[model samples]
Target: MDFNFLSPVSDLVLAHNALLSSQALGSKLRIHSKNQGIPDLDAVGIAIIGVLENRNDVNYIGEEFNLNEIRKSFYGLFPGSWSSVVADLGDIEKGERVEDTYFALKSIVSALLKLNIIPVIIGGTQDLTYATYRAYDDVIPMVNIVNVDCKFDMGDSSKPMKNNSFVGKIILDEPYNLFNYATIGYQTYFNSQEEIDLMDQLYFESYRLGEVSNDISLVEPAVRDANIVSIDLNSVKGSEVSLNQKFSPNGLDGKEICAIARYAGISNKVTSLGIYEYKPSKDDEMTAMLVSQMLWYFIEGVNLRVRDDDFADENSYQKFITLVDSQELIFYKSNKTGRWWIEIPFLADVNNKLKRHTLLSCTHQDYIDACSNIIPERWYKAFRKNSV
Candidate 1:
C-alpha cells in the first residue's frame, strides 16, 4: 500500500459538521487521521484523495491550495441512498519537484485501481490529469478519456508539460495507450485554430458547450463510453464560482456540470475521475460547496449504476440492424434502462484492446439518424480507430 505517500486529514476538518437534525456526510466518512493508520481499502469502493500541487497552472503561479474547505463542504452534505462504502484517504502534499507529485499521484491512483477502489481526485491543476492517464498503462491495454473543459488542452507537446497542454503529453508519450480522446463543453474561442484542426487530424471528438448545454443528454454517450474522465473546474461559468485562474465567461452551469459528473459516475468503464483547476479563495464558500456537490452527485451515480455491458444476454436487450451506405449498423437497446449502444465491427488480427463487435454507447437520436441513412459520427470514429 503506497499509503505512505499520503498525509492524514486534520481532526478539525473531520470534526466539523453541518447544523442538521440528521447525520451529515462528515459524521459518516472514515478518515485517515493517523500517520500509520489509513482507511481499510476493502471497506470502501470509492476513495477520495486531494493533490496540493499547482505549479503547472499557467496563470496561477505560486498560489497555495488545500482541500480542507472542499472536504468540509462535501462532508457537511447529506448522503444519498447509496450502497458503496466511501473513505477520505487524505491529501498528497507537493514534492520537491512537480514530477515527484505526478509520480506519487500515479502510484496512488494505480494502487487504488488494482484494489478495485475508484479514486475521486481533487486536483490542483488540470496537468495532474497526465498522471491519472499514466496510471492506466499496465492496468489496461488501452483507454478512452473524456475531458470536460472549455478548451482543448492539447498544447505544444514538444514544450514542457503544463496544465494548458498536458493532453499533448498523454497523446504523444510512449506505449501509445490512448485510443480515443473526447472533449465536452469546449468553447471555440479559448482554443487555438491549430488545436481545433489537430482534433480533426487525430480523429478525436470535441463537442461545443452550446451543443451539450442545449441538450444535456448529448454528453451522456461520450462520458458513458469513457474509461477515465477529467473535468476542469474552469469549464464552469465564472458567475457560478470565484475565478482563481482558467476563468471562463460562459461555460456549463452548475446543474449541467453536475449532470455530466453523474454521467461519468454511472459509467461502469470509468475507473478514475479528477476535478481539476480549482483554486480555493477565502471569500467564496460557494465554489467549495459546488465542488462538494459535484463529488456527491458522482458518488450517487456510481451507486446507482446499472451493469448492461453484456450484450450476449438476449433477454436483457433488443438488437436492431440497419443498412446505410452499404454498411450494416448494429444497435442495442437495454430492456432495463432503455440505454442504447451501437456496435462497431471488430477487425481480426489487429492490435486492439476492445473486444469483438464493440458496443459504443449512443443516444436514441443516433439510432434515428442511422435510419435516415446518416452514419453516426461516433460509430464512424470508433470504426476508424479500431481498424487502425
Candidate 2:
C-alpha cells in the first residue's frame, strides 16, 4: 500500500485518453493522473507500473526513454468481454542510483503481491527482473521463474550486475528462494558455453527457439509452473518489432510472443509479469502496438482462466500410471480443462526445496512418451533437483 514511489501518468497520455471512445480499454481503466492522484485498488486485479530506470543496462549510454507511447496504444484498444478490474499506477522515475530504483521496484511489487494484486511491469531494462524476483524473498518460500528470451542472461556472478547478467545475481543472492528457472525461445548462439553448462549442472529447464516456434504449446507447461514471468522484447525477431526493439534476426515472431504472453496470463500460479528492454525511437508505433496487443492477449487469457488444477476430487481429474525403465510415473489429466500434469514424488529424507509431493505442469505428449519408456525431461529435472 506504500506507493509513494510512483508518479502519475503524464498529462499527454491522459489527454489522449479523454478522446478515446467510451468502450475503449482506457475508459474502463482506473488511471493515476496529476489531478486524481493514484486510483483506489479496492477491486483491482491487475496494476500496471512503468519503470524508467535502465542504468544497469550493459549498453546504457545515458539515453532517455518513456512508456507514454505504449500507454497510448494500449488505451486506444477496445476491451474484450472481461470482468477483471485493472489500474495503471503510472511510472517510477529513476532514483539517484540504479540500486535505488531496484529497491523501489521491489518494495512496490512486494506490496502488490501481499494484496493479491498482480503487477504488470513495463521496464526500461531486462535486469529489472532481478528486482521482481527478489520481491518473492519473503512472499513465497519457493519461486519458479519462466523467462521468454533469446539468451540465459547468466553472466559471471563475480562481476557487477548488468541487464544481460542479472540472472546470475538471482542465483547467487541470499535467501535462496529460487526453486526452478526455465528459459523459452533460447538461441544457442546467444548464450556462452559456460552459461549453457551451468544451466544443465543446475538442472534448470530450457527450450530452444526452433522447438518453441514449431509448437507454441511447449511454452504452456513452463509458464504454468512459474510464479514470475519475464519477457524480453528483443526475443522477437528484428523484422517482427521496430528497429529500436529489434535485437536478433532470428527469433520468435509477433504472434508467437503474444501467445507466450497469453499463456503467462492464463497460469494461476503466476503472480507477476514483466515486459522489458524497450527502446524508444522516432518510428515506434509498430513496437508500441505490438506491446499493446500482447497486453491485450494476456488480459484475454486471464479472463479465460479456469480452476482445473484441483485434483482432490477423483471425478475432477483422471489418473494414469505408467512404468518406464521400472520407474513408476504418475500423470493426471484435468477433466475440466483437459490439461496434463506429472507428479514429482516427495523425498522425505533429503533437504530439498519442495517439502511435499509436487505436480509439474506437463503436456499429453509427455504422458505418451512415458508410456513408451521415456521420462519427460521436466520430470527428470525436478526429480534430480529435489534429490540434490
Candidate 3:
C-alpha cells in the first residue's frame, strides 16, 4: 500500500472543496490532502490519479499542465445515486526522466488493480497508456484494450516511444500480455494505409469516426470486451474542446465521448480508465467541464452495472443457433439485460490463448446478420486469432 510516488491534491483545490455544497461530489470524496496525507482505500471502488508527464508528447516543448481545473469542475457537480466510493489520490509529478514517470505510474496502477480499485487516470499525454498496459503484466493473464481516439497511435516501435506511437511499444514490448487492441472513432485520414493494413493483418479492431458517429451503440460490444479503456481528448472534435486541446476538425462530440465513457464504465471486465491528452489554456473551462461530465457519466454507469454476463446457468440466458454458410454460429442473449454474445469454439489441439470456450460480446444486429447467412466480421477475426 505504499503510494509514496503520489503527491497530495493542491491546497487550492482542497479550499475550493470546503466551499462546495454538502451534496457535491467533492464533499463526499476521500481526498489525499497535505493536512491529512493519503486516505485509507478500504472499500473504495475507484481512485482518481493524475500523471504530470508529457515529455514524450510528439509536440512537446517543455510546457507544463495541471488537473486542478478538472478537479474543481468535477467537485462542483452533484453525485448521482452512486454506490461506489471514490478517492482522489492526487498527482504523480514528472520524474527526472520520462521512463521514471512511467515506472511510477505503472506501479500505482498495478497496486490499485490488485486491490480491485479502478484507477481513473487524468494524464498529460496518451503515451502514459503504455505504462498502464504494462501494469497488467502480472495482474491478468491476457488483456483487451479499447482506445477512444482519432488516430491509431501505433507509431514506429523501433524508434523511441512518443504519445502517438506508444501503442507500437505495447505491441512489441515484453510479457506479451495484450490479447486484443481496438480503436474506436479513428479518422482514416489521420492514419497511413500501412497502419490500417497492419490492424487487419494482426486481427486488431478499428472503427472509423463516421461509423461510430452514425451509431454510438457500435462502441458497446468493443468496450464490453475490454480490460482497460483509454481515451485521448483529441478524439473529440475541435468545436467540442479547447483550441489547445483540439487535434482534428472532425471527431466525436461531447455527448458521443461521454457515452463512450459510460460504456467503458459499464463493462464488468474493465478495471482501469485513463483520459489523456489534456492541455491547459486560459479558456479551459469548456474542456475541463467536458472532462468532469465524462467522469460523472462513467461513475453513473458504474452505479447501474448489472452482473448479467454470467452464462453458467442456462435459465439466465436464451440460446440461439444459426448457420452462416457451412459454419454454425451460437448466439446467447441475456434474459436480464438483453445483451448478445457469440461463442468462439475452443480448439483442443492447438495452443489456445483462451484455454476454454469463450463468448465474444456482440449486438442484436450481429445475430440478424448471422440469420441472413452473413458472418460478423468481429467473430471471423476473433476466430482467426484464436486459431493462430
Q: Which structure among the candidates has the greatest lDDT? A: 3
Segments of candidate 3 deviating more than 4 angstroms: none
Clash count in backbone of candidate 3: 0
lDDT-sorted candidate list, best first: 3, 2, 1
Clashes of 2: 0
* 1-388 per-residue lDDT for model 2 (tens digits): 6789999999999999999999999999999999999999998999999999989888889999999999999999998999999999999999999999999999999999999999999999999999999998899999999999999999988999999998999999998888999999999999989989999999999999999999999889999999999999988999987877878799999899999999988999999999999898888998999999999988888888899998889999999999999988999999999999999998888996778889999999999999889999999999999999
TM-score pick, better of 1 and 2: 2
Window of ten residues with lowest summed lDDT in model 2:
240-249
Candidate 3 lDDT over 1-388, as tens digits, reads 6799999999999899899999999989999999999999999999999999999989899999999999999999999888999999999999999999999999999999999999999999999999999999999999999999999999999999999999999999998888899999999999999999999999999999999999999879999999999999999999988768877889999999999999988888889999999999989999999999999988888878889999999999999999999999999999999999999999998999999989999999999999999999989999999999
Q: Candidate 3, TM-score vs. the true structure?
A: 0.99
Give the TM-scores of the predictions, in the order they appear.
0.96, 0.99, 0.99
Name every residue pair that clashes in candidate 2. Answer: none
